[model samples]
Target: MDWRLKRNCSMAPRQLLAFYLSLCILSLGIATMFWFQGARMIMTFAWIELFAVGLALWVVARHATDSESIVLRNDRLTVEVANGQQVERVEFQPAWVRVEPAHGDQSLIELSGQGRRIAVGRFVRPELRSQLAQELRHALRRWQQGAARPSPV
Candidate 1:
């Protein structure tokens, strides 16, 4: 079984880029009109505003794909978290993994075993984080039970 969770992005990176391009064109066109009218400061301020907004949008686009994936296959449980440009992947034996909230019921879910720990469920709502933890625990339990059953020769 596998569970994949991702940020709910209203605008994709391509759509965001297109929107920024249109905004730049409109702003620059207006600034050019002001420059022809002898309001040179408007053009300068327009450039500054565009630069600031572009930087902010870039940051948003960078994290648009942030997500967490948990996979249970064979005897291993793998968790992968992607945040901005960094990705952290951890694997554990299903029998030894622990799933719980990091701080409280509304806090992020923590998975720990073998002296390693990582938090997940950041994209999930705080009210539903405990449910996510419970689902993970159930999946791990099922995996462990399946692993323990005997197979025909």
Candidate 2:
């Protein structure tokens, strides 16, 4: 079983870059017209505004692909989280892992075992976080049960 959770982005980073470029063209074109009319401050302020918007967009683009992936296969359970340029990966045996919320019910779900812990479900809604936790617990339970059973020779 595998569960992938990611942000609901309205636009990809490439699309965002295209939109920013178009905005720059339009704003700069209008600013140039105002500059020709002797309002040179318009061009200066346009450049400043575009710079601010570009910086904000760059921050957004950096985290556009942030995600959490949980995979249960065989006797191992793996959790991988990617945020901006950082990635964290953890593995545990299905029988030893514990699934619970880190804080309150609405907080992120945490998986802990063997002196290691990781939180997940950031992209999930607060109201539905419990449901996500429940699902993870159910999957882990099934894996544990399967691991406990003997295989036929």
Best prediction by TM-score: 1
Write the residue-wise lDDT of candidate 1 on 38-58 in tens digits: 999999999999999999999
Candidate 1 yields a Cα-based lDDT of 0.92
Estimate, for each residue in 14-67, the C-alpha lDDT of model 2 and write its tens digit.
Answer: 999999999999999999999999999999999999999999999999999999
RMSD of candidates 1 onward, in order: 2.0, 2.2
TM-score of each: 0.94, 0.93
C-alpha lDDT (0 to 100) for residue 119 of candidate 2: 96
lDDT of 2: 0.93
Question: Which clashing pairs does model 1 show?
Answer: none
| Model 2 misplaced stretches (Cα beyond 4 Å) | 147-153
Worst 10 residues of 2 by lDDT: 143-152
